[model samples]
Target: MTINRRKFLGATVAASAALSAPMALAAGSGKPRVVVIGGGAGGATAARYIAKDSKGEIDVTLIEPTRTYYTCFFSNLYLGGFKEMDELGHSYGGLAAAGVNVIHDWAIGVDRDSKQVTLAGGAKLTYDKLVLSPGIDFVDNAVAGWDVTAQNAMPHAYKGGSQTELLKAQLAAMPEGGVFAMVAPPNPYRCPPGPYERVSMVAHYLKANNPTAKIIVADPKPKFSKMALFQEGWANNYGGMIDWVGEEFGGGNVEVDPNGMTLSIDGEVVSVDVCNVIPAMKAGKIAEIAGVTQGNWAPVNAADMSSKADADVYVLGDASQQGDMPKSGFSANSQAKVCANAIRGALTGSRVFPAKFSNTCWSLIDTDNGVKVGATYEATDEKIAKVDGFISSTGESSEVRKATYLESEGWYSGITADMFG
Candidate 1:
């Protein structure tokens, strides 16, 4: 699963090309408007690109309730104490400085017929094109006997803010040699490598403070992304400290007793000191309110991430049902660029490039030990399809691993800057 240097360099060039500040916008008579909901990787990038690329020809408004965004990606490192809370937090001031109308409010309803969005603040915003990247909401029945109210006890820590701090505190409060159990989510969740990376980081923390602490992962999925590399790292670095049970082993049949802090799998009860129950997820509530979601996620056309249900509306990131792409920030950012290109073209008669997408996922196994998997994609008539892909292999030199980790650090800085400003 190693990436050849030539293939890697070539792909890097093409992906970088898309990130270049867009060309001078074609002059248009009236400014077309784009309203972006949820200022995360997708929404922020779409707003920035449309405004920056359109060069004052497109009025971009962004709706996000939170003034600061804490990224779910790399939050695992924060739990492991490898990163500070401020490192994960980002301010919306940068977006505002970039000429985006940053509104701190919730979007309550969508009237597609009139191309209007109703906000919780009792205001209305009309847009010629709308971008929705509202992230995820948990399914009520995804985990039996566990609901939002029970989340305080067995923290999911999936959203990467206070929940992350809560999980970190729980880890620190665990008595020596105590058990830490997790109920990993099913397929098509944000950051495919995230749960496993969290496990690695937890193991790292426990080894230093609670050497005998045990971790049990009851995962509904039979296998996860980067399984081989993660298993090897576990064996090498934290042998006998972690146990992973897949669906065939009844890991999917789990129920929690929050009062007792018990996790039951296959009718077998296991008392746990700390519990992490990540449930199956669906599109954010706004997507459902907008009537754009089909089943659990919003369906979109591959060409420009436009909603299949409504042409003027586009969905990106974890909320989209686009094919062959994992629910990742990188994927969302890539999709936004494509959507921006199309929107700009429609609004100002600007040049529309072919929709080419790329994503790279990096996971840290230990300090200076990281691994990655990536692919280039194309928008097909039916779905977004993979073009070429590569991954870090099982056996690599320490030099290569360190370099990979450093590469991820560089990417984190660059992508955040791209999204925020």
Candidate 2:
């Protein structure tokens, strides 16, 4: 089954209400323990909700290597010079203060049978339940002649933080009239409209700094999210600066030489100053290590996001193969709340509300010009099914577009606050 791609408010209400309830500890263990790996949108939110809602009844440990988590959601804005790197970075201190044991360390192995996680620092953590929300990792050889080793040269910047900064720096340093190329990913990748939004942002940047620069996109898919809207925005905002090659035009048949800095499309090679290669993605390594993954993703029951392989294991966000929800930060945060409630119920006998989800993806095309596509969802036996949806149109008024961008700013503020504190 194909998942529908898209975010809204419900978080502030849910967070405040959950804090009001007091849950009792499970009878068997001193405290029902939940160990979450990868402290991003899904893991951080899940850890915070379980700890906050459980009210000392459950022990929550979040194991993450990075102390400052950079959000992938708005990193494109950083590329466009609209946001700073610090704006995208959030410290884990909030989770630590919320009675969550926030450990800055890598979770190297998951012994599902033993109910233990081994850390790179040579420590072991035992848990009654394990939540994996490790976002995404690129598939091996998904893009020919490119790998993690070539990242410094080609720079996918798909993940956040340093990579994003590197990409922006490369963009800024490009020679006048130099080429900027992007090898777009296949379907089921993170953020359906991300690449196009990025192109728009890059164009915005170059138009101001290096007006003669050219932007090229080789997309494997025949089309993409918010296609008409994005195309229209490109034509209006960055005329004659962007060229998009879809699958029929051999965009799918491509290769990159990182060392030589050349991108070859349909056997036609051209040297580019900067190339952003977003490869196919899959669930992070920890899920596969836990033996909860079926193939590239971990399959979960739609109701509670419990692993199909292990009852005690749950997967959230981009790592999950639950039906009909796109791989997105907003989707992950939504899934985290549902997973948190279900886990709280199973461990502490707290009320487990029916699982419902929602997501909104807001993309900035130019200054004060934002467009979005979003939907609400409900959990079913089959998957997280889409209920209703909405999108910004092609020819919206300037006031409408500006309002949409401002709305996105508000969402970013709300969601981050919801996740961190």
The reply for model 2, stretches above 4 Å from the true place, is: 1-11, 14-22
For candidate 1, write residues 1-421 as lDDT tens digits.
3434445445444644554444454455556789999999999988988877666778999999999999998899897778999999999898888789999999999999999999999999999999999999999879988998998899989897999999999999999899999999998788899999999999999999999999999999999999999999999999999999999999999999999999999899999999999999999999999999999999999999999999999999999999999999889988998998888887777678899898999999988999999998999999999999999999899999989987887777767777887
**lDDT of each prediction vs. the true structure?**
0.89, 0.91
> What stretches of model 1 exceed 4 Å from their correct place?
1-30
Residue 48 local lDDT, model 2 = 93
Instruction: Estimate candidate 1's RMSD in Å.
Output: 3.0
lDDT of 2 by residue, 300-382 (tens): 99999999999999999999999888899989998999999999999988778889898889999999999999898998998
TM-score per candidate: 0.94, 0.97
lDDT for predicted candidate 1 compared with the true structure: 0.89
User: What's the CA error at residue 170 for candidate 1, in Å?
Assistant: 0.6
Question: Given candidate 1, what's the lDDT at residue 106?
Answer: 96
